[model samples]
Each structure stands twice: as structure tokens, then as C-alpha cells.
Target: MKTLGIDIGSSSIKVAVFDAANGSCLASTQMPTDEMIINSPQKGWAEQDPNTWWSYFVDAAKQLSALVNMEDIKAIGITYQMHGLVAVDGNGSVVRPSIIWCDSRAVSFGNRALEKIGVEKCLQHHLNSPGNFTASKIAWVKENEPELFSRIRKIMLPGDYIAYKLSGDITTTAQGLSEGILWDFKEERVSEFILNHYGLNKEILARQVPCFGHQLELNSEAAIILGMKEGTPITYRSGDQPNNAFSLNVLTPGEIAATAGTSGVVYGVSSSIAYDPQSRVNTFMHVNHTTKDPHLGVMLCINGTGILNSWLRRNATKGLSYIQMNELASQVPAGSQGLTILPFGNGAERVLGNRDLGAHMQNINFNIHSTAHMLRAAQEGIAFSMQYGVEIMKTVGVIPTVIRAGIANLFQSDLFTQTVADITGATIELYNTNGAIGAARGAALGAGYYSKSSEAFSTLKVEKVVEPSRNPLLQEAYGNWCHCLNQQLK
Candidate 1:
């Protein structure tokens, strides 16, 4: 038995085929050698065409088919970039380019909704302000583009749109709605209050589906395009952060998962209904959540993380490979000898109260500091920014004794991983897994191919463990970084 997992990311589309019997990945590949472009027509706006994602999905499926028999794939799972708004017409054609997660254009609408709905009511029922979420984005379209809004038949998240293309079903998960600020935690359903406030009809939203269930099956048309057998069930769907936690087996409370991709996120699982009073760290339903066994993922996200490193690689380092950059960064001492970086340039960061402080590099010395110092400073700054969010997470009872992460992206850097461990004082467990692999495992569990949920991760293994080491110099450096951040905030 086999399962196919597709992870729809902002950068690219990744597909992995997993053996259901052993949880081993048979083949994996990503489409587009370069990162997919996020079209920015105006400042603070980020959009991508849903058809572009479909095209990449088809391309990736063709590549994977070359490696294995597509007919052998029994089930499919989808994990996607969260909080995006994709509107479709009655014929299932996209109405507009998707307004993605990092876009800050909807901030004002979210703030207005927060005030209109009352902060306490929103925090108690929704667990977050409608800040830059899908609902707010839809509201933006309603107010700004009335014609487009009137033509919308269904609104879907990024994953739901992809699934619709595959199965001809417009559906979304409770977790997906929650990430969009459309799910009412108090009622455990869609938020009519938010919808009314935004002047949206409930009919615009996609039909609700369980995160793990027999959600939909591949149709003949999709099968032909994907080069897969018809009737392959897509059993699981989730936003990337919750799915990231699921990928690392961090389903229970006190277990935490961290990832540093284009953005940095620390997701901690908790059973109790909790919310940060300031609405800094957002909470949503975990992939394994249920009415009886409620699991909430408290997530702290830093908008700028790996992108800062990528910027340095492209402009500063002159196209150095990530490995070469890491090697150079490792050579520098901790603290980068007084250089500091604040990686908040990408967009409005949720951790900083939706503040767009912009990226900053403080205290540069031309005579003493080299490109190696700049590289190390960028990594340390990102780790410190995450530490800042983790501190806020601690306030909401998400104190992490250890953090689990896949051995990819920024975690691939020893210096970056060690810095995070030392600064946060949490043991870092590196896993041989990614979002695509996790979705595949989730598919097996959802499709009943595995007898138990634990059976789905039978092959998940810890590749390495990095314990926090006592280093006063690094501690002082972190303190310095914090000081710089505090000054900028003030």
C-alpha cells in the first residue's frame, strides 16, 4: 500500500510518495527549480494564482510517476500554506489570484473587525483577532472589489482549493477555518458573528470536512491530469503549521514543534483552551483535535527568518550555496562580535502585535566585521527573534523543555540549530521528516490503512539531539540582541 502527500508551500510545491506498510518514503520531488514568485502589485500585498499551484502539482506528479507506479498510490493527503483566501465561481474557476498568508493588506479590516466584535468576545470565542487572516482578506475584497465579491460562489483556503481541483469538491477543515479566523471556538463551528460583521454570507465558505477522514476521491479528469489512478481517496488536509506539528508526532500537550522555512514558527500543543491576552501568539485546532479530546496548537510566528538568510545569499554573499553559507557562518564566534540583526522585514509579524518594524542590522563595523560575521549575525538574530516569541509562548503555558524539528531548511545549519537550543534552553530533536512525509503518514491513518494513529509514525526516528550547552558568551550575546530589539520597539 502507498500514500501520496502534497505540500503546497509559498515557495514551491512538494510531493512525496510513502509506503503505508512501513512509513518509508519511496520518492519525493519539488517543482520549479527556483522559488515560485509571490506577485506583489502593491506594497504589503502578496498574491499567487491558484492555477499556478495546479500547474506545479501536475508537473510534480509527472516527475513522481517516473519514479514509481502512480496507480499504486492508495491515498492522498494535502498540507498547505495557511490563512490564504481563494475565491472560486460556480463553475469552480478561480475568481482572483489568492491573497496569501504574509500579505498585510487586510490588517486594517482585521483591526476594525476586532473593535466591532469587541476584543474580549473575539479573544474568548475566536482565540485571536481577525488580523490579516482569510476572513479579513475576503472582507477586503468585498469592500474594495465588490464585483469580484459578488461573483464568488465558494471561498477556500489554499489546501482546499488544491483538493477541489483534484476531487471536484469544495471543502475545508475546522482547523483551516480556525486559522482563517472563521471558526468559532466557543460554538465549535463557523463564526456567524464575524461573518455578519464583515457582511459576508455563510454560503461563501466551503463545506466543512474532518481533517482526517474520507474527505474526497480523485475524479477521472484529475486522474488523467495527475497521471494517477481514479478513485484514490484524499483522506487528510491541514494548514502547514498544524500539519508540521502533526508531522513531528507533537500531538499531545507539552510537546512542541519548530520550523524555519521562509518564516519561522514554534508550535506548541496544549489541551486547555488558552489565548494570549495581547493576541500575540495565535491558537488553532491541531490536526488530531476532537470535541472530546481538544488539542490546540499555540503558534508563535516570526515573519522574517530564512528569507533574511536567502536575501543575504542572493545580494550579499553573491549566490553562495546554503551549505557554503552555513560553513562560513559557523566559522564566526557567537554574537558576531557585536553585530545584530532584526528580521521583521517580511510583513506584519504576529508575534510583535502585528507590527511591521521592518528588518534592521545594527552596529556594523567595516574594519572588523566580515561577510562571515554578517552571516552569523543573521542566523543568531533569527534564533533570537524566535526566542522572543518563545518567551511570549511561555506566558500562555507553552514552555518547551525540548523542541522537535525536521532536519531541513534553517535547522540544517548546525550553528543555527545550536543557537536556538542554547538561547531557548530546550533540547532540539532533529527528525528525518518534512510536511509532505507527514501528510502521507496522516493519509494512511485517515484512510484506515494503519490500524492505529501511532502505527502511522512507526518509522519516524530522531536523527540527532542537540542539548543546550552552558555558554556565558552566547548568553551575553543573546542579551545584547534582546536589548537591540527592545530599543527598536521603544
Candidate 2:
């Protein structure tokens, strides 16, 4: 009567149970009384204990059981942060702390591997640079900690680790492999070129499994711990982004999904096999991706939006709250009176050719521009950056007609949302859903409760809709912003 989905994230473990008949969330909650700590033993490194993730999962299962009938759960699914490296020995015990998605320790390894593989060859086959992804992290281990590397019987992504814990099986989907930069899209298999380059063998990698099939059945040990029936099949698994897309029904080509958090991402799904020469957006396998029917999630990330806004709040906003800031800025007419603030102050942006054009506050007139103008310009700049990235996505055939996003993060800002919608000329639909809900829907579809993928989104609630008003001011601001960006690049 219900399908369960667990989102294993860096921040927390979110679990949701979905009603099979109506596709509505029956129960959902995130565990861990506090945010899980990301240990940085050294700067630019992020790691977490895999055992801690399992503990949170156990706690979440216990919490969910108290809220709903655990016996009604017919199938299971998992979604998690992408590009993490979890290694285990033959005994299936974790050998090291997980090198999470945000870890930069493997950057040099990834860059060196790319040079060895040749840029064009890597883009052509790997569909990505080996940069800071799972394989590169593994390569770092192999070279930097050879003794530790030798003991790693197998390596898997974050979600795969959770699945392994539940089912006592080590397997992954092609989608998972692709996110880890371990898949050869051209060859449609594990990248032997990378393995050979990194001096690793296929034996250490998890076996490939179907993304929407019976990946594995729950083992007695995990079942008893979680108060669930043993042998329950886990039918779906994916990285958080792809699963978030699926949750919003952005499955087929031309459908789009966007998330604006510390980093802003616009994921557009398309059937065409394409790659950006500048690597503005990374391509990953969508949940429904197949060799026969290619579903590519062309992801465009603008590394600044929320972080820039937060910085402004802490330092520049003086005493105004975010709501007050939004209200005040809403009064300022478009273009912020010719003042432009480039939101790229966060760090190097991929969309801008991986350049760190250190957040320029340009064309400033201290007399003319007030705090309101700065706020408006900052929001517009962030929106323009998204518009800029989406333009790059278009170069690879990912033009968004409708952008879907959760009713969270910067999308919560009417000024920000309207700016993005108007500039891109796309209808923005805000959904009251998250990654766990999407994985739950995926679970039902995989369990054959829904005949088609679209049916799974029947109860997906749309909180609001922002249709483009053809706002010429936003267009003018974007043009002005782009000109300034071009000058900065030169």
C-alpha cells in the first residue's frame, strides 16, 4: 500500500513513505537532531562517517515506524549526494570515512588524469572531466595512501553504500556510475580508460544494476533493525539531483528542473547526446536513461546565488531582514539604476569557463545607488548568471520552456524567481516536494504500481506558477550584465 524512499544526504537522512494508490506522501521526516558534521581534517577536504549515515537511517526508520505502518511498505528506493567515494573491505565494513561530493582533495588528481586522458577524448567518452569525482578521489587514495587503497575490496557511491547495508549486496546503476565520472557514455560501460589511467581494476567497482528494477532485497539483519519485512525489494536508486528531477516529473526530454541553494542548479533533460565545449554544464544519466532512449540531464550550476545573498545579508544589509530586503528591492525599478553586481564572488564558476571573476560590484555610483539598489542588483545579477548558464545549456540543446523547482531556497524569493522566469521566458512552477518524495514516486513506478512514469506525479502539488510577463527591463538588465561579464572575461 506504500512505497518508501530514503534520501541519504550530507546534511541529514530524509525518509518518506508514499501512498501507492494516490501517490501522496503518507509520512516523511528527516533524522538526526542536528546537521551531520562534515569533518575537514585539512582545508578543502570534506569527509563523513559512513557508519554515522547508517545510524541516522536506522533512527529515521524507527521514527517513521512510529508514524505509519511499516508493514504497508511494498518497495524501497534510495537517493543521495553524488560523487562520494565509500570503500569497504571483503567483509563489507567501511574502510575509511566517505570522501563526500564537496571534497576538493582530489582536484589535482582529476586535473592530472584529464591531461593524461586528453581533454577531447575525456569529453567525447567520459562526458565529463574526472575532476573531483569518485574516480579521481579513488585515484588520490591510490597514490597518496597506497596502503589504505590496497585494502579497499570495493568502492561505491553514497546511496550504493546505504543499499549495500540494507540488502547486503554491492551494486550500482549506470546513472550512479555516470555521476561518479566512472561511466563511458560513448561506450555505455564502465570507463576502462580511467581505470587503466588510475591503475585500478573493475574488481573494486560495484556491479551495474537496473535503476528501476529489483536492485536487491532487504536482508534480515537490516529488516529487524528497522522493523520492516525481510526480502522487500529496493526498486529505485539515484543521486539527489536526478531523483529531485524525477520527483518533480522532469523525466522526458525538454522537461526541466531547477534548485537554488548555496549553489544554483538548473537541470534540463533531453534525448539528444550533447556536451558543452566549455564544460559549463555537466551531463549525467537521468533516472530513466537507457541506451535505446537516451535521457540526459544537462545540469547548469551557478555557484553564487544563495551564498552571495547570504554574504550581503551578513555584511551589507545593515539591519534589514531578508523579507525587508526583498520588499525594499522590489520597489527599485529594473536594472537597479545601472548598477550591476556579479554574484560569482562565491568562487570559480564553471559556466564562466571555470574562472573566478571574483564577484565584481560594477558600475557603482555611490550617490545614485542606495542599499535597495545594491540588493536589487545582486538579486538580478544572480538571476542573470542563471540566465547566462541556461543560455549555455541551450548551446547543447537544453532550452527550458518550463522550469520546475521546489518551494525552498532562493526560489522562495519572489524577486529572484520572477527575475529568472522573465529573463528566461519560461513558466516557473514551484512544487511542494523534495528528493525523498521523488524517490518514493520512483519506487512506486519501479514496483509496477504505476504503469507509466507520469502517473507517479499525479498528486505532485504545484505551490505557485510564475509565467513570463515579457518584462523588457529584465532583458535590458541581462544584456547590460552580459556586457560587463564579457569585459571582465577579457
Candidate 3:
């Protein structure tokens, strides 16, 4: 049997076909050859049309159908960019453009909620301050776009919205809700306290479902649209980070997963409930979490990571390939020769307490610094930013001695991977699998093709392992980078 996996990402929609019996990806493709447009009507605001996602999804499915037998695809699973707010009317039409993960427009509203709801109460129940999450985004709509809010019959994360499009069922999972700050960790359900505080009707929320299991079936209309058989069950759904961890088989306590794509993330699974006091690093239900076995994932996200590198490539390097950029960066020694880069330009960073400090490059000397030096500094800065968040994660008991990541994005860079390993003091394992493949294997597990999660990933193999080197210069460079970062924060 084959399984279909769809990853609804911020930049593009990805689809993959996996051989369920062998856990090998048969085919994969992405829609819109170029990155999808993220509309920003105003600074600090990001929006995307849900209809655009559906259109691209259909395009992606059509491409996938040419490479695989759609009829043989047994199950569908979805993983999406987390913390996005999608609202739909009773007829399932989008009420407004989705407020995506990187949008910082709702920061003030979230801060107000944090103050009004009381810090202790929020920390205990929600495990995070209402800081620029989906809940806050919804509240923004209600306060600013009151008419649209009144018509909203359902609120969903991006993955939930895609699943609804596929199955015509409005449902979400605990893991999805937690990413939105809607799930109450203490109560193990949607938080009525948060709903009441935001004046949001609980009815607006989608029906709750388990992360795994047959949640919905592909409807005939969607089947016809995608040239797939009707009634194929959508067996699994999760936010991208947790699904990335699941894809790597980092399911147990202390096992960690890292990803550096449009954004950077460090996700660690834990058996106990833990919260960061500052609410910098957030915790949510892992894909395999249950009331009895409660597994939580402590996550640290840096909004600016590969996007910074992409920015440099576009504005500075004049269209160099990422491989070229990596090769150029590798030429520079540690610290980028006293050049420092602070990659906080993308949006409000949670690790910086939802502050939009903007990207900064300091200590540049016209005579001494070269383009290669700038490229290396950018990579080192991104690594240091990750290490900064990892420190907060350690405070919450999710320490990582070894980190697993896919051989994609920044992990493809030897310099980038080495910097992360050396700075964070952890062994980095690179895998051949990506998010779509993970979602496919998760579909197999949820559909009962595999009786256990282990069976689903039994074929998973590590491609390479990177260990930290005892480079004395790395520590000194990190210290200088931290000093610059602290100065900016102050």
C-alpha cells in the first residue's frame, strides 16, 4: 500500500507518496516552482489566502498523480506550518485571509491578554502567554474585523483547513490546538479560560480529534479534483515541528529534533509538563501525546534562519546558489573575523519575547570584511540564535545531547551544521527523510498498516552524524556574538 502526505508550508505546498510496507518515499513534488507569495498589507502583518493554498494543493496533487497510482494511495496525512489562524464561514468559505505564523501584528493584543488574564494563570493553564499565537490572531480579527468575526463558524490551523478541504470535515487535534495556545495543558482539553478571556465562542472551534486515527475520509468532490479515489481516510495531522520530530523517530523523552527551513526550530519530547517561565520557548502536545502517557514537546523557534541566508543571497550575493554560499562561507574561520550578524529581521521572535528588533550586522570594516565573511557571519549568527533558545529549553528540562535533523535546508551546509553542533554542544544526526515522508509514515501508523509507531519508522536510517570539534576559537567567537546580541537586546 502507498500513503499520501501533504505538508502545508509557509513557502510552498509539498506532496509525497510513500511505500507503506517499506517506508520508502516513492515520489515527491512541490507546487508553484517559486515560493508562494505572503501578502503583507502593512508592516508586521502577514496574510495568505486559504483559496490560494487549495489551488496550489490541487496543482501539487495533479503533479503527484503523474508519478504514482492515485488509486493505490491508501491513506492521507497532513502537516502544516504552525500557529496560523484560518477562519471559515458556515458554508466553509474563508472569512478572511489567514494570519500566518510570522505575522507580528497581533503582538500587542497578545501582550494585553497576558496582562489581563494574569501571568500565573496563563502559565499554569496555557503553558504560554498569549503571545502572537493563533488564539491572539483570532482575537485580533474579533476586535478589528468584528463583522468578519461574527460570520466565522469555524477557526482552524493551516493543516486543519487543508484537511477540511480534503475530507469536508471540520476537525482538529490536541497537538494542533496546543500550537494555537487553545489547548489547556492542565485540563487536557481546549481552554475555556482562554476562550472566555478572548470573548471567543467555543463553537467557533473545530471538533477535537486524536492526532492519529481515522479522522476523516476524502470526499468525492476533492477526489475528483485531485484524480484520487474517494473515501481515502486522512489518518493523521500535526503541526510541522512535532511532525518533523515524529518523522525522525524522536518520540521519547530527551530525544530532540531540529529543523532550519524558512524558520529554525528545536523540538524535544518530554514525559512531564514543563513551561518556560518567560514564555520564550513554548511547550505543546507531541503527536503521540495522550492523557495517560502525556508527552509534551518543548519547542524553541527562531523566526529568522534560512530566510536570512536567502535574503543575503538575494540582496548581497547576486543570485549565488545555496551550495555556493555554503562553500564561500566555509572559507572564513570562526566568528567571521569579528563580524557579527543578528538575524532578527523576519518578524517578532518568540525567543526574544515577541520583540521585532530587526536584523543587524555589526563590526563591519570596509577593508577587512568580504562577502564570504558576511556569509559566514550570517551562518554563525543563525547558529548562535538557535543556541540562545536552546539555553531556555534546557531551563525547562528538555536538554539535548543529540539532535536529529533532515538533510535539507540549512542542515545541507557543512558549515551551518558544524556551527550548530559546536555551539550547542550536541551531536547532530542528519537523516534522509523530510516532513512529507514523515507525514506519510505517520499515515501508515494511524491507518493501522503498522501496529506500532516503531514499525512505521523501522526503515529510517541516519545518513550522517556530525560531532562538535574542540575548536578554541568557536567559544571565543560565540562569546563575542553573545556580547553583541546582549547589547542589542538592552
**Candidate 1 lDDT over residue span 1-490, tens digit each:** 8999999999889999999887789999998777899888987889999999999989999999999999989999999999999999899999999999999999999999888889999999999999989999999999999999889999999999999999999999898999999999999889999999999999998888889989999999999987888999999999999999999999889999999998999999999999998889999999988889999999999878888998899889988999999999998888899999999988888888888888999999998899999999999999999999999999999999999999989999999999999999999999999999999989998899887777777788999999998878788888988898889889
Question: How far in Å is the alpha carbon of 60 misplaced in model 2?
Answer: 3.2
Give one digit per residue, the lDDT tens place, for model 3 in 364-481.
9999999999999999999999999999999889888999999989999999999999999999999998889899889999999999987787899999999988877878888988
Once fitted onto the true fold, the runs of candidate 3 whose alpha carbons sit more than 4 angstroms away are: none
Model 1 weakest lDDT span, ten residues long:
450-459
The residue pairs found clashing in candidate 2 are 247-438
TM-score of 3: 0.98
**How would the candidate models be sorted by TM-score, starting from the highest?**
1, 3, 2
| Alpha-carbon deviation at 444 in model 2, angstroms | 0.9
Candidate with better lDDT, 1 vs 3: 1
Q: What is the TM-score of each candidate against the true structure?
A: 0.99, 0.88, 0.98
Best-matching candidate per lDDT: 1
